[model samples]
Target chain A: MNPVLGRVFPGLEGRSLRAAAVVTVLGGLVGVIGGESVVLALVLALAGSLATLSLRGRPNPLAEEYGLLPAIAALGALAALATPSLLVGLLAGVAGLGLLLWNAESARDTVRTAEPVEGLLIPGLGLAIALLTALSLPTASAAVGAAAFAVVVALALVVWALQGALTADPYAAKAL
Target chain B: MSGGSADPGPLKFRPRAVALFGAAGALAVLALATHNAVPLFLALPLLLGPAAAATGAPRVPLSFRVTWSSEGSRGEVEITGRLTPSAAGPSAGVVPTFYRPEPLIDRAPPEVRSEAEGIAFRLHWSAPYPCLVSVARPMLHWRDPLGLVERPVRVEGDALRLQRFPPELARASRAPLRRTTPLPGEVRARQLGGAGEFFAIRPLAPSDTLRQVNWRATARAGRMLANDFRVERTGDLLIVLDLRPTSLGSEIDARLASVAAAGAYGLAQSFLDQKARVGLALYTDFVESIPLASGRRQRYRLLRALQAATPGETAGPSERLAVSLRRYFPPGVTTVLFSALADDESTLVLPHMRRRGFPAFVLSPSPVPLLGQLGPRPTEDDERALRLLRLVRRRRIAEAWSEAAVVEWDDYWSLSSLASFFARPAGRRAAS
Candidate 1:
């Protein structure tokens, strides 16, 4: 790692944060390529960068840190507006938001311990994306429509809450 | 990894958490109004981030045990400790932030090593100068997984206070004690007729004891002869540190003061070891003196005073040392002065001390040599000006020799010369 970049992302010492960064970039690229909007790609990339910056340099609160989540959400909304397929836009936006949040959370404090938070977050996010993709597929039967989509969303939320409670290793949580 | 960073205190909700929820809510409202699932999906992570962080909040209170010890004056501080949670619970790891004040130069932070028992860390802080430095106990920054909450717990321990000075100073006991007080001590006084080093054999007196009779001397004299030994009584040493500001400027004056303090500490320690009554007088705007006393308590007192001395507004007249001496010390006490003798005023103090019956020895840490290291001269004219300044300083010190004994101390680091100088009488020392 570059010394300058190392200082900016002190949490990068762990593999989890590096993986989060790679995942966020890949997700952002997928959304931009799928939607065919270069502008959305740049905006999503900026959002990822902003979230990363929030956890940078000595764990003190950055002046622009609070704007991170809102900025990512706004970028997602823009992606939605640009794409013809709502599902594609949603997947891309969700992927960027999820990965960036993971990256930020992986380094929560300055501790350099392995993150169990990633275990809980990554699986929950993967399950949500998979269910959403399955429901939105055109090959789906007529029975799996808006009603079915709502049911699946509710089930995913329940699974997410259950997963958080069960997989929660409170002691395993370490500093970046 | 530097310990100089600010402390991130106790567990509290971060604004980022509020922003995450707020953004999530706004996106959700937009999704409902537009009847679009895309905006709703965008809100998922932001909402879940804080939600998951909330669930994983630290349940057990965290604390740490930190202790520090210094090897020597030049050695680094060895800090070791372990982190402990209030209950057998969360395996969450926390980074403890160490506080590094000015004069502490190390860049590396404490390295944490987890053992079978708990999380332990070790740190070493190398101080570069002979001065006092205090490092605060480390603060454990316990952060929730998603960084939604932060709690900085101060470790249970006192701050590490390290007083570094030259170890050679312990040899200050070898310094000669020419003058002596009436009190009993280790060094031999000039007077005869006591149980000490042999002085001379004299005709027997009526009160002389049989043990005092030197049989060989009596046989040579063909009469009763007695042995007269020098009295082994202690001496009163008043170490005066001239803190008065000189023309050398505050920066040089501060360095000079530091040097003087180190020198004074060594001399005091040496003399105190020989059972001499050592007192201190810091001659600043007025005068502060530690009354003449002996033993370990006096050594501690002198050390405490030297550590506290700082350079600032000190321009006391030369007469203050003399007048203060009369009040706090005996009239004919042996006085050792630590001064830069940077100006005429500084040189005058020794004469004042001598006039008042106090035999004085001036250890002048030369400011002339120090000025050379400050930096290069800007131009030839500046170089010429510095030369003239040096000449003037030389003349001032030369004039001071006519009054009291003076030793020009050019080198700051090496105290061997000063140690040898202290062993000899003021009359024998060559003028600076």
Candidate 2:
């Protein structure tokens, strides 16, 4: 195994074969669920399958470390296709949201470990938006749900906008 | 006491503050619509925005750790760091930062824009959520990127102390005529005759007691030649290290000290290998002494002591070394003083010890060109400094004695130079 790839995705080389098998089964399931829309399901499943396979040989340890993000997205997308009911769609949406939150948390940990701060404003606001969106979606009407979703999307955009500004300066610690 | 001692079951997260502000804004808006009250709703975001921002903040728990290889070289060492988040909610997804502040011996600090591999995840959903994030880097240095706030964390680890010793003469080529004066309790070699102080006479050889042996002289010489031998016992050697702040400059001083310490350590090891007893003494004006002792254990102790020696303000050249030396060293033991010939105060006391017949070897670190790079100086100051340094060099040359050996180490190139110089068969034959 390439040292760089191994480093980027610890244990990924070993799991590549397993990941391929699981992805194949998941892809077939997606195709079965699409029914009349076989071509669309096949394409999405192929995209997800390729991502999973490509992650197996990612040459950067960080890329491998973050490989879970795409995997989670693919799984959520697959679940949404497999069961098109509102409940299943909601569950898939929640799962996708959970994966995104997980990705954000991982990114935050990477930042905090490298550079620590008293509080993180962007991520906090993002979490707030997610919580409010999730809670209001269940209790309120479609219009209210849409409003909450808009707020969540807006917060995500705000956080994304602040990424460059929030980048911790390497020499900032030495300033004091 | 009971009321005060009662536990506040895990801190509550209340939305009342947000609700109250929202209510007040709603009332203000209603009043505005009815034209009855002040417009307070305009302040809603100013008040509730920061409060909501504060509430949503992630409490990240950070710690630093440092580790190095056992080998004494400043090569690449793996740095492992972990950052754990203590809050759940959306805050658990935050990416923490890591960095190494000090420069490693072999490798320079990694490029500023480089990124590290890290994992962040929540361990549980409890009140204080613990999220763990781990990262590894070839060299230690990193930072965290959380918007609006940044924290710096440093990890302390084992620091490798790389040292190389001055080379010595090979044993095979070091042979020289052994000189000794025989006394009542001295060990003797069965040689035909000897020179120097007299010893008891035995029967003369066939080629012996003739012309220069007069009747009285022959009587004294008997049948044997009047042979003498000096006592051949290994002497105790004590190495004294002066760690005064004034003795060194900030940058090169520590390296100078380390070099001197390493030299003394190497020489002591050589002496021990030659069956000599070795001891060590470290002194500064404030810290009086680390007493001298002899043996393998003492050698290890001295190395450790040397490692711990730090320059301080209280120590200077004029400080009395005799008081400390007298307290720890045995009478008439050979003493080696390792110092940077920086101040005249230390030079003042050297004559007194020489007067006492102790062979004092002064090993001075040769000042190098690195000092010039440390800071800017006037051209006149540089010229004056060079002139003063030359005078000091002359003084050291003038002060050289039969019992003293002064060695100046100016560059890394000089170690092999000196070793080769001393190891020459010609020098050994000439000295003998």
lDDT top scorer: 1
Task: List TM-score per model, in order.
Answer: 0.67, 0.42
Provide i-RMS per model in Å. 9.7, 17.6
**DockQ of all predictions against the true structure, Cα-based:** 0.16, 0.05
In model 2, the Cα lDDT at residue B7 comes to 29
- Tens digits of per-residue lDDT for model 1 on B18-117? 7767776887687667655555556666666655555444444555666555563343555565665533434454655666654555435456665555
Highest-scoring model, DockQ: 1
Model 2 root-mean-square deviation: 18.6
Model 2 chain A is weakest, by summed lDDT over 10 consecutive residues, at A1-10
How good is the docking of model 1, by CAPRI class? incorrect
